[model samples]
Target: MKALLTKLAFPILNALEKSEGSYEYSPSHRTILKVMGFLFMVISAVGLYFSMKIEQWAGLFPVILFAGIGILCWIVAFLGSDKAVSKLWRNRNE
Candidate 1:
């Protein structure tokens, strides 16, 4: 029971821990995440505009696209970015 609780809570804790921004993850990785996030927002905005200007179905497409990209960014951000950055720094400083 404790193990199960820990397993579930660990992911949550990791999420909260990762969010602190105090750790200063690798700049390149952070940049990539930021760019992807920005692109996702921009694409979504474009999609929304097109959708509004066109058909309801078309407008919804941007919403889906943005959500998908946002999800992709979250996944990439969680799995990577900071680690890659720190590794690069370690190499350069050494």
Candidate 2:
């Protein structure tokens, strides 16, 4: 299942995974990333619910935004390596 997901998200993972650089790693970073992803997903769900309830197409903007961010966060947090997480955090070695 993880392999299949990694394949599915190849486009997003490619650049980050391929970057050449040293990075600082922390277990907490990944933990916080997962937490933020879950929160963004929750926000997206609420946005979707409100959009449907209010019957307003404009609300979909935030829904899509949050959902996209949430999905990205989830992909990186779960599928990416420690290096990828560090890259996302912009913690490349100086």
Candidate 3:
């Protein structure tokens, strides 16, 4: 069982580590992460709307799950690199 679980988890762990490593404070990488985060937020919004419309309380679980993921993505995109945040602030001031 442990071996099976390890096999299942290894790829996910590897992907996450690889993605974390890709955050190199580059403008392009920041833009991509921000865009992905926004997309996740949009998906979460849609999920929320459908959940409310259908009045399925059970459906809220998935909505909340997506919202959490969206929030996480946004947090990572914003907080992953101090340099990216500083660059954004500098651009805004100009």
Off by over 4 Å in 3: 1-25, 82-94
Candidate 1 residue-wise lDDT, 1-94, digit = tens: 6556446545533543344223445556656765777788788878877787876774786688796776555444544445433442332332
Write down the lDDT of every candidate, Cα atoms only.
0.57, 0.92, 0.57
lDDT of 3 at 60: 77
User: Could you list the CA RMSD of all candidates, in the order they appear?
Assistant: 8.8, 0.8, 10.4
Q: Which ten residues in a row have the lowest lDDT in candidate 1?
A: 85-94
Candidate 2's residue-wise lDDT over 16-73, tens digit each? 8777858898989899999999999999999999999999999999999999999999
Write one digit per residue (lDDT tens) for candidate 3, span 5-92.
5465554334343332122345665566678778877887888888889887787787778777666555545553444433432332
Measured by TM-score, how close is model 2 to the native structure? 0.95
TM-score of each: 0.46, 0.95, 0.55
Best by TM-score, which number?
Answer: 2
Clashing pairs in 2: none
User: Candidate 1: global Cα-lDDT?
Assistant: 0.57
RMSD of 2: 0.8
